[model samples]
Target: MTRRDIEFDAEGVTLRGWFYPAEGATGPAPTIVATHGFSAVKEMYLDVYAEAFAAAGLNAVVYDHRNFGASDGEPRQEIDPVAQVRDYRHAITFASTLAETDPQRIGVWGSSYSGAHVLVVAAIDRRVKAVVSQVPLVSGLANLYALVRADFVGGLRESFDVDREARYAGDSPAMIPVVSEDPLGPAALPTADSWTWFTDTAKLRAPAWRNETTLRSVEMFTEYEPVAHIAAISPTPLLLMPAQHDHLTPTRLAIDAYERAREPKKIVILPGGHFDAYVDGFSVSSTAATDWFVEHLQP
Candidate 1:
């Protein structure tokens, strides 16, 4: 239950993080790096998973993506998939140096956008012993297609605006609301409940959480495709936890990624939608994650 604030430099960017050690952890223990999804802070779902892992005798490191939360970056809130994947590598490297962690027993757990990130990281970094990609966004192109198909004109306009802003500022672009006011709506905006939850959560965060990112993040979709790298990670343990009714990242996409991945893998389909995995019915996915890490990393 012991927690500490930490900072590390990644590719020249000063990144912020939290380290959670098991209550009685005195010796080397399996460790987990918990990364959050797009537009979310480490304080969101990472804490939930971190506490659970710590209770189970694992040390947990949760960090903010550059440009969001307490992390340092320019053109704030811009989604850079390449940067995200790089940050994962940096986090894993940093976690390996912790005195309380077993350097060889390192696992990466990512949700939503980061789900795909962890996979890409594991593929490139043999040091990653295990991976958990929860409700992953496998193909950025497919995701964009889905958005355009839902509302072509609106999607186009949003993309144009994001691009214009990024070009104008000569830096990273911003993004629109990924969740919708109406869960069933064609275009996405934060749901009323989601907005409320974020507002409440913000009150508990530190000063480092005050940054806002640009909207030109759509560019990353065309540049980074994590699903294509799945087969390259042969023999590494992977766990895909997809929500049955996930609207943010389609369940079908995650299933396709699972099918393409190499052996030593598992697919756990849980009930509820995307946000539900963070709020209501979260225990379903959380428990599955705990068991997965215990079986793969702790062993």
Candidate 2:
């Protein structure tokens, strides 16, 4: 497997990352386009997944979402679900243009936030032949409610309004930690596991990973609903992988969304929490996705 640094224009923003050509392939081969979740960048184990796909004779394009990691965008660390979805389509277009890519044999693989994005992308973009959405956010509003305390919900909304006003007045967007040591602290992801996984992964694999994002990013997240597009992803084969003990995206919510998806779809229940899918359960998660892509894309 060989990896090369690559970038392409997504609208006007320049998104950058690695492209791994399928190993031992003599011609154009099936390709998988992937990006990370939430505030994650390509360095945080995305390379590992890409290598796995490449070694299995499937080309892999792995990049960071705009405004994070090596990607170019304004407001540095903002998270806009709508923009991310559009970027995924742009990535597909770029992938289709590659010499090593069999445009018709393209599959999409995403986990967590991008997982949800792939669901929406596959529904609207017929160019996507197959999809693997792992531990995706089904309903952002529901997820916010699940992760936040009832008493804090109103305050959180108020903070959003306050931040909007500040931004309207030309003040820089307010920043918030992506995760915190104190579970009850104000952060995008408050789970103990999120803190551990993000901090530890950053330390070991991605020094460029930051701990902050714009406050409005959280507001935008609460308004996202990718599951609304789930049922439409049929005809295009779908593989839904939800971790058994996930609380960040909630296992039940993922299962419910999976039930709504039409046929030519399958689900693999991973044996750990959300973050575990990338670490402890990586072999299971990556293998399931690799096999699915192989079955459908025939790389």
Candidate 3:
């Protein structure tokens, strides 16, 4: 196998990425660009997915969004939805120029927050031939509403506190633990498996993955909705894999978005919550995703 860490210029930002090619493979092959989700880095998912695609004779490009991970940017952990989408587009453009890649067969893969990004990117950019959104958060408002309903007063207080700290520290607002020990709260903050996945993954990262995102991120996200553009991606294959018991992103939202999407789309519902598929013990969903990309990209 051939692997290289590369950097590319995108919208005045220097994006960091990794390219993986199968060993002894020659000539161009189908390429997939994988983007990470909120508070996650490229290194988290790149290795597993890249190896899967590369073993199937496909090249994979995994990139870190600017302002997060190893990518160059100020105000670390600030979630800029527009910038994230732009980075996705730049990754595709960079993949297209690779001599070992089939530019016309480019695919986009994303999960959680980025899952929605993949949809919007493919809709606006006709160059994207295929997309795989795993347990995607189709609507920002839906997610926030869920969060609020779970703990209206507490959620509001937390948001304000985060915003204050962010401004005082001259940084983006920080979020509470996705899973906590408290009761009567968002399941994402209390689930045992969610904690395991995050802590274990943090151990594998440098500086221990400190992802304190801007509190105003919610404010920005409330106005951004990827489901609104699903129809724009007609003719291109879209795979929607929603976790049955997902708490981070409700499965119903994903199903609704898939139903609204145009022809040439597929929906696969797996058993588990939002983060289950990313960790161990949820091989069904992960395998289904791998197969979906392989089938569509046709390496």
lDDT of all the models against the reference?
0.78, 0.95, 0.77
- Give the per-residue lDDT of model 2 (tens digit) for 1-299: 56899999999999999999999889999999999999999999999999999989999999989999999999899999999999999999999999999999999999999999999999999999999999999999999999999999999999999999999999999999999999999999999999999999999989999999999999999999999999999899999999999999999999999999999999999998999999899999999999999999993
Tens digits of lDDT, candidate 1, 135-194: 888888777665455556476656666678767888544445544446544323234544
TM-score of 3: 0.87
Task: Please report how far candidate 3 places residue 257 from its true position, in Å.
Answer: 1.2
Tell me the spans in candidate 2 whose CA falls farther than 4 Å from its real position.
none
Worst 10 residues of 3 by lDDT: 181-190
Give the per-residue Cα lDDT of candidate 1 at 35: 79
Q: Could you tell me every candidate's TM-score relative to the true structure? A: 0.87, 0.99, 0.87
Listing every candidate in turn, what is its Cα RMSD in Å to the true structure after a full C-alpha superposition? 3.2, 0.7, 3.2
How many clashing residue pairs are found in candidate 2? 0
Q: Which ten residues in a row have the lowest lDDT in candidate 2?
A: 1-10
How accurate locally is residue 260 in candidate 2, as Cα lDDT from 0 to 100? Answer: 98
Measured on C-alpha atoms, candidate 1 has an lDDT of 0.78
